[model samples]
Target: MPSRRQVLALLAALPAVLGLPEEARAAEPDVTAGPDWDATDIAVLKGVLAAVYGPNSDRCDAVEALTASFAWLDGERKALVRMLPSLFDQASRVLVPTISAFHDLDPVQQQACVDDWAASPLAFRRQIFGALRQLLLAHAYADPATWPDIDYPGPWLGRYELPIHPLRFGDPELP
Candidate 1:
């Protein structure tokens, strides 16, 4: 059922996706996750943030941003996040039987857990990982505190009032 082009495209990406030394495209996978978590759950969240965002990610108040983002989600999503930790055990491919609590795991273990879920063989696990990551990332990018590091000056709209000199919303004809 494979088309030649699709097959070829996958074949082309295979070498790079294989973790080859020279392949830079897959050198780093963009992994992100956000959760609608409880106060008690946040202790582990900070560790996950440090692991997923790397050592220098503490400048932004990610905890607050994540908390706010979590607050905005509905009941179903909130429940999923509450349960995300338990799902971690199902994501790992390694034979490191009897995984510890996420908070108890070292930083390296946390990162591995995220990576495993993101790239899990089970589609649902990957889907949840994708959803969690996207949720966090969307909120983080929207937070003004995160802008300085990325060098984004706040939105231009705030600084500029475009002149509607020739036309207004009502008039369709050109001025």
Candidate 2:
């Protein structure tokens, strides 16, 4: 009969004897699950935009900024949403608030943001799209997904998808 000490030692060494090596067991890398933006995040964004652009900026600027912001956020959200599409069905949760918050503004107040922006269509588009690209890049780096099928549309598909989708104003590839 094996003593308790011998039994315990054998149990500990059983894995090696069975050919299951310790090296085979490794922990998975940590990936953040999803966007955790809350109301405070919205407030922070609003405050930041207001501060950088100034309080008196009009609706056109606000909407244009928002359009650009959404384009960028779409890239970020799409990256995550594609990874766990079923889990992150509520990707619009982050964006909807931005629209609603702007919608809540009275007409005059909204226009103020618009008037403050550059009149050149190209400049406006550039600023908006640039901001969005940066935002999405930041999001992708933070929550990378290993799955390939979860990728966002490439340039070709991106153009096709944006205009048809209500969330996008126009194609990012456009001049």
Candidate 3:
């Protein structure tokens, strides 16, 4: 019973109404240049990392490295990185509503807040904790400075001892 004009109007609006090309609608913020984390946010992240890792260790350096690495990450990982600041900020409030921010709290309070997230039953909280852990721990331990503490021998300096062999896909001796 719709008029010709009405039908044409609906057809023209169909894409927007039905949310076609969902990716366009769901496009994440561009963090290609780097994460938008400010000094306060970075400090908060450092505090969280201190709690997750150990205080005054290499965590601050690892955090700086992780922040710097955001620029080279793909869009999905960049989006994840972007979420971290807001998520931590919100968690700070949820954990201590009276505090102005997570970093404002004492080290023990900050650790407790981070512990809450680490022990959370929600998958998102757990995911955030896991991501922070993996990022900080990976960067911290991978640094050459920490190698001495862990007794890790530095990168091998030995050159190739074995001569290179050409590929032989079907050779019976390959196994």
Candidate 4:
């Protein structure tokens, strides 16, 4: 049985023993959620996309396209969206030197952090970077609006626009 004073002393020392700062021992604030992501998560992702794709160019608006891509992803790629917050949190903890979220960093810092992750020897970090890059590229290229800028003339003869033509092999009047 410990004295009350001894118990108080032990409680005060507990944080240090656990390797956590007193402030860090407190409960974290709830992340403010958006439709598919928390605000910070969305900001972190947008920053990453901007770093990888570059700012909107004359050929295509990368930011707009990325926004649209996120919207598409929310509907079609729920798993990815669901994973983003945790992934961003993990990256922030691993990459940021000081106590700060990824979205809290400045653009230059964000880019540097992402670059560091990209250059990391760890296979998983590289894989995450590759996956993010591929996601951006896939979305950017998939949009028909971006095709002309990429110099893809699209289908040979507006095949998508052609109405369903019934088989004419057996019917002479089908033409």
Candidate of highest TM-score: 3
TM-score ranking of the models: 3, 1, 4, 2
TM-score of each: 0.57, 0.20, 0.65, 0.54
Leading candidate by lDDT: 3
Ranking by lDDT: 3, 4, 1, 2
Candidate 1, residues 68-142, lDDT tens digits: the string is 566556656666765664454333423233266566667787787777666668887777667656655666667
Clashes of each: 4, 15, 0, 0
Candidate with the larger TM-score of 3 and 4: 3
Root mean square deviation (Cα) for candidate 1: 17.1
- Pull out the clashing pairs in model 3: none
Error of 2 at 117 (Å): 21
| Candidate 2 lDDT, 1-175, residue by residue in tens | 9999999999878768877664552332223333444554344334334433444422214423333334334335545423321221122223333343332444444333233322325573345434533443343323323123347443465455555445457777777
lDDT of each: 0.63, 0.39, 0.73, 0.65
Report the Cα lDDT for candidate 4: 0.65
Model 2 misplacement above 4 A: 1-37, 57-175
* Candidate 4 or 1, higher lDDT: 4
lDDT of 1 at 148: 74
Give Cα distance to truth, residue 163, candidate 2, Å. Answer: 25
lDDT value for model 1: 0.63
Model 4, total clashes: 0
User: How do the residues 1-175 of candidate 4 rate in per-residue lDDT, one tens digit apiece?
Assistant: 9999999999999988999887876753323323355666656667777677665523444435555555444333556655764586567666657446667778787777778777888897787777776766676666676786669877757655667677667677655
Error of 2 at 134 (Å): 8.8
